[model samples]
Target: MWSGELLDLDAYLARIGYDGPVGEDGELRPDLGTLYAVHRAHTGAIAFENLDVLLGRPVELGVKALEDKLVHGRRGGYCYEQNSLLAAALERIGFEVSGRGARNRTRGDTLLAVTHAVLVVTVDGEPWLCDAGFGHQGPREPVPLARPGAEVVQGEWTYAVREEEEGILALSILREGIWRDLYAFSPQRYHPVDYVLLNHYSSTHPRSVFVARVIVQHPGDSVHHPVRRALVGRELNRLHADGRVERRSVEPDELLALLDREFGLRLSGRDAEELVRINRAGD
Candidate 1:
């Protein structure tokens, strides 16, 4: 159950740089074409980031907070925040949408917890997988859910969905000439409270990776995307989309400037200083 009236659809579309056709009544066009356009625009405009977690700032999953931070503040967020915002916008636009949780299997063989969030949207009676949260490796468009082994290609990227078990689906991406499992999930629908718990564990748990370092990611320009990971006051690793990565030592003095310039983060002097201090302490 979503409070659709609370979401400003126009603001969300504007924030994502989507200028697609809104109906005469000022509602978003509820069709597959519009969904693809919106998904691409969202992935391109908004970024996948976790700066707040690293800075010890509370990551609120509520709709109003998401609108303020991601839309008005011109900031980026991780999976929960990103997908949650997208889901709300879709619901407001009259699309049938539901939240699904998945285990992030990109790292290794071990089955991780259900820490990722994705959206399953039905357009014209067919279900499509729409995810705007997964940084560079994310799909730029919706993938058909009916086809068991369908490959969806967007620009230079290629993704696939395969049936892993009776009701489980495995999403994989082509990386280095290999198909890698990105995540796996069932058809079980999740609620806002479920994501709240996941977000809490991710943002606050000691073993959670979000607290260990600063990870800022944005869809790249043309042929090159960038993922900036910093150990604050130590080293900053910039991974490019062209497979060329550059690593450089970072001093505390230059952290603020780096975040502002490279990650497009708008931070006050006090906020910057506090983030730098936190990163140095490795808390």
Candidate 2:
């Protein structure tokens, strides 16, 4: 639960580009329509990025820190930061929210550790999974927490929630004609301290992919838009809604401008130059 003063609703709503109706008491009333609107607005406004981790900066999880870095600073963050912020806002808006830990099985067969975070929101006695941290692979809207084989189609993506075991749910997406598992999570609730441990390991560990390369993502222009842009390492990729992908390597000199123009990130010229140099040297 969050207090009104701790989480500024006006600032948050503005940051996410949400202008939906609110109660006369100046509080958001939780409902399916508002939840969907807020979820869509957030995913479209804020990006899923790890540039701070690559820059060797500490990732903070506190609400104020998240507000400063993400909302006010006009920057994007990874799962922990993004989901934590969303959970706080949702809670402040009179929704029942809980944090859950998940394992990323998208890249390999072996079950990975609990390194991902998601939100379980209850409305009208039913649960829904809301994730705004997954860059290009996440759903555009919340999906009802249902049994295996239950599918939710959003634009070009079709997602399913599978019951891997008793209390564990696996979220999979249809990609290239294959149903690929994105991540798996249980019903147990997580806390900010749990995210602290996960964030430290993800930001500092040498083997962590976030620290190894530069990754940035922002949603497409509209729900009907077919393309989303992402910068992975030295390549910029445009992912089409119909499974068509266009990619090109980014030159070192053009990295800063691209980040600012395409990703809506503003960084000091010195910092930008250093990032480009480090990224190129790593390649």
Candidate 3:
């Protein structure tokens, strides 16, 4: 049973600039077609961002709130907001979408404690993992859940599914030929409130990377810097766009300025100096 309102399929598609009607089979549409549609909606319309933290706004998990942000505000959100919103939309369109959570092992065992969100969909009797809310764009193809060899390639990221311990499944990705942890979760039941707790920690906890820095995604690339003003060494840093990766030092004020000029983000109530101090310590 759906927890909230049934999403308006036409309006949702319109929100993302799709003029076509929802197919009769609902979300069992052509896999490649659906993948393209999702990509277009996510990349062309929404602005992947993290301005809420800077503006002192709590990231809410309600469907209405997510619709307001994604459809009205024309913004991109973190995992909780993104995956929940996508799941709701898919459900309305007739896809068997479920809200699931995962552990982000890439950040280390300590950071792995928090639960992250993902969406699962079934198409043509096959389980497909779909995530348009991830900061980077999604795979050009749907990731088959039942097959060990299922894979999708997008630029430098190759995503695949593999069985993990205790019969639980894992989602692994190859970044530059090295397999790394993206997230891990199963079909265990989940609720919006469950995400609220993790969302709070991700946005406010002293140890959260988002609390210490700001991240903004542009059309074809993204930029990350400490939320405060201090300089922290980037674990893996590369700025690529227009066929080149520019390695440059971004100052506190300049970072703020770029937030407005490039990413269409205008922040308020954020203490830039404080952020810098926190960032310096992490560095």
Candidate 4:
């Protein structure tokens, strides 16, 4: 149960800039069109960031907490927060949404823990991968589960999910004429409590990448021209839809400005100062 009833649907819709036709009861239809619209609108509006981890704060997965920080507070969050809010909104709108934990394969070939959170939505009796949390290189719209291994093009990007060894499905992006694996997952469904454990390790573990880096990503938009800008630690990379990657290093003085100007993340004065200090330490 995603506790979708507890979510303020109006505020959530407004936050993502998705204005759907509402009925007399203010309900949007549960269909593929709504799913695609919400998925695109959410990713385009909210950024993906780990400022709380960098600020030495805990990441809460509760729907209310997510609404407070992400929806009301106008801040961005990493996977758990992103998809949890998405799940709540979709469930509230009457879509059958389930959680799936995926092993992030972008890092390397060695088998890593299933730390990434993705969603499987059932629409018209078919499963579709709806993920709003995989950062800049993630899909802009839902990928059909029924059409696995078939190329689905969204704007300038192309994605396909291939059947991997042992019932695993790997989502890949076509980059520079190569189908590079982004992540893979099994059929096991995860509960809200499951994410609590994963969130703990991600935000607290000393060796966890989020605990070690200041990561913020913007997967661009219509007005922004579909250019993905990802700032990991000190490196700022701009990935174009045409596969052009513009890289640069972020100076301590340039940190806050870059976060606001590039990723649309505006931290408070205190958070900004602390982030600058951390950047200066180069940790």
Candidate that scores best on TM-score? 4
lDDT of 1 by residue, 1-283 (tens): 5555698877888888896667788666789878987887788787788888977888998888999999999898999999889888888878898889998998887868888999899998999998888766677678898997877776666689999766999899765677888898899998888889999999999988787887766555322234423333356665444445677877766767876776667778777778778767763
Model 1: lDDT of residue 167: 94
Tens-place lDDT per residue, model 4, 1-283, is 8999999988999999996455677679999878988998899999999999989998999999999999999899999999999999999999999999999999778889999999999999999999989999988899998877899988888899998778899999999899999999998998888999999999999988898778898777743365888999999999987789999988889888888888777887798889888878865
What is the alpha-carbon RMSD of candidate 1 to the true structure?
2.7
Q: lDDT at 122 for candidate 4? A: 99
Ranked by TM-score, top first: 4, 2, 1, 3
Candidate 4 lands at a TM-score of 0.96
Weakest lDDT window of 10 consecutive positions for candidate 4: 217-226
Q: How does each model score on lDDT?
A: 0.79, 0.84, 0.59, 0.90
Q: What ranges in model 4 sit over 4 Å off? A: 21-25
- What TM-score would every model get versus the actual structure? 0.89, 0.94, 0.73, 0.96
- Candidate 1, run of 10 with poorest lDDT: 222-231
TM-score of 3: 0.73
Q: What are the root-mean-square deviations of the candidates from the true structure over C-alphas?
A: 2.7, 1.7, 5.8, 1.5
Candidate 3 ranges beyond 4 A from true positions: 1-11, 19-32, 108-111, 137-141, 155-157, 218-246, 260-283
